[model samples]
Target chain A: MRNLFAFISGALFGAGLFISGMTDTAKVQGWLDVFGDWDPTLAFVMGGGILPMAVAWLLTKGRRPALGGEFPTPPAPKIGRNLVVGSVLFGMGWGLAGLCPGPSLASLSYGGFGHWLFVVAMLAGMMAAVPLRARLAEPAEA
Target chain B: MIEQDWIWGFVGGLLIGLGGAVYLLVNGRVMGASGIVGGLVDGSGMRTVWERVAFIAGVILAPIPIYPIYRTVETHITSNVAVIIAAGLLVGIGTRLANGCTSGHGVCGISRLSLRGITATVFYIGAGGITMVLFRHVLGVI
Candidate 1:
């Protein structure tokens, strides 16, 4: 049952990304081209997303949600190297491809070879990180 | 068609938020693509991998039924296969390292005013903006 609802939510979210300009690399690229022929479309998307989520947060404040579990809160660790470096790397990639995971996965249907290439590599990169993180975590390293 | 993109962007963003809210309300999970997918790959959230996989299935399949309606959903991603793969790899690894992406940190995290989420969002976006400037303006390769 939980899995079913998760799928439904993902479908809805995927539909949103598909309908929004997020699925189109051109739109995402254009939005990023702030010094060029910039497009403000994404700003609207961000605003639109924040409004409802804010409301939901407010409503669910001081209580566990309708699901009878705690909200998926952020981890409690302080800011560190991984967060900054990883995000910067992510930004560079976003600039390069103009597709994040949501749009990247959602748009796979129509993304053709180029998009598939990105997805496959993305998976490989993700899998690769597991061992890399372990290696870094090894006390012998530093 | 292009002029009204923000309108669709807004609507789609709303649906994304609504989907996220529904997921949280019913399943006690955040609809963060990177975290969901990354967790499965990195083997941290092993207990809920099935739920994450189900959501991924939804994201992958949701656009199919509506493909006819949004036939214009093609990607203009660059043809440099190496760059494409590299970008994907970076995004995959980076988002995992950072623990979120646009959906998780930008939408869900930021909406809830979580410090970590906001910090991650700012860093990634700032990095993206700088990357865009370098690639598009300074290098003229994009």
Candidate 2:
């Protein structure tokens, strides 16, 4: 039952990406173009996503845990250098490639060859981080 | 007043957001795509593995139903495969460094009114914005 729900939810997400035209690289690139044929599509997409999410949050507040038994959701982070640095890196990559991880994966199912490289490189990047994160934590242990 | 594209975008975002909410309400877990995927590799339980595999499969197969409805022409901004690969790698690393992707931190985290999610999202958006300025405005990629 849990697996079924997750699968359905994921399907919905992929459908959203495709319908929003987010899977299309041109639309993504258009957003990147500030002066040249600026496309507000991505902004619109994000805005659309946020509205319902806001309402859902309100509805679900104070509710007990539902799936996979009980677990406390992680605490939200305070604003800091991590936020700034991470955002900058994410935006730079998005602007350059017009693909984020979610849509990148979605695009792959649609025969999006562009996402092939993005997906590969993304996996590599994740793998690379295991050691870096370990190294960063080493000093804390010391 | 609504353009066809905007209608599609709005609907798509809503579905994705709603689906996310359903997952949270039912599972007590944030529907972070990367985390779900990651769980497949590292998670110990049989349930966890099944859920992750199902979710990923759903995401991959979602475009099939929608392909006939919106037949937008696909376009590629950068044909260079290397660039795409590099961008994906960067995102993977960034997600790991931050401890979540946009779906986990940006969508689920923010919805729960988490400070960390809000901070992570800010960075995620900021990164896209700055990268756009640099790539399109400064470097003239777009």
Candidate 3:
């Protein structure tokens, strides 16, 4: 049951990504390209997504998830170095490829070999992050 | 006054949010795509392996049926191998370090008014725009 719900949610999310034209690298690049032919569609997408999710957060308050576990709570909203540096790095990649994690995965069916290569590299990066994070955290711990 | 692309984007964004709502309310987990896959790669998500697999399966498979109806799904990912590798590594490392991406931080985090989410979004989008200007205009490499 838990897995089923998760799968449904994933499908909906992927379908949304596909229908929204976010799977298109050109469209995504257009959004980032403020100087060039700018695309405002992404703004609408963000607004549309935020409105419902804001309400969902409200609903989750004081209410346990329908499933058996407790709702996962967010940690303190800290403005940490990792967050800033990581985000900038992410943004650079996003601008370069016009593909983030969601769209990258969602578009795999038709994204061809280039997409496959990107995913493989991304996974490798993710693996690297484990050790990298540990090393970065060492200073703070010390 | 809404453009056709905007309409699609908005609707898709809403669906993505709705998917997030379901994930939170039913599965008691936030629908951060990178985190889901990252955990699997880093071996941190081994305990909930099935759930993660199910969600990923849904995301990948969702577009299969949509392809027939839409008839075309274009990703436009760049063919430049070097750029692809660099971008992929940055994205994977960045997202894992920051702990979210467009869907997770941009949608879920901002919706909850979490400072970390909002900050991350700003940095990433800002960085992406700058990178776009640099790469597309100055460097002309991407």
* Top DockQ model: 3
**Clash totals in order:** 0, 13, 0
Better of 1 and 2 by DockQ: 1
**What order do you get sorting by lDDT, best first?**
3, 1, 2
In the range B17-83, model 1's lDDT, one tens digit per residue, is 9888878777877778998988887788799988898899999899899888764777789998878
Candidate 1 lDDT, A25-121, residue by residue in tens: 8888788788888888888887778788888777676778665778766577467667777788888888889989999999888789989899888
lDDT of 3 by residue, A1-142 (tens): 9899989999999999999988888888999999999998889888888888889899998999998789888887668777888899999999999999988999898889998899898999899888777665525533
How good is model 1 by TM-score?
Answer: 0.92
Deviation (Å) of B59 in candidate 1: 1.0
lDDT by residue (tens digit), candidate 2, B14-51? 87787687676776667776666554433333466877
DockQ of each: 0.73, 0.61, 0.88
- Model 3 chain A lowest lDDT segment of ten: A133-142
Q: After superposition, how far is residue A60 of candidate 3 from its true place, in Å?
A: 0.7
- Which candidate would rank higher by TM-score, 1 or 3? 3
Clash pairs, model 3 backbone: none
By lDDT, the best candidate is 3
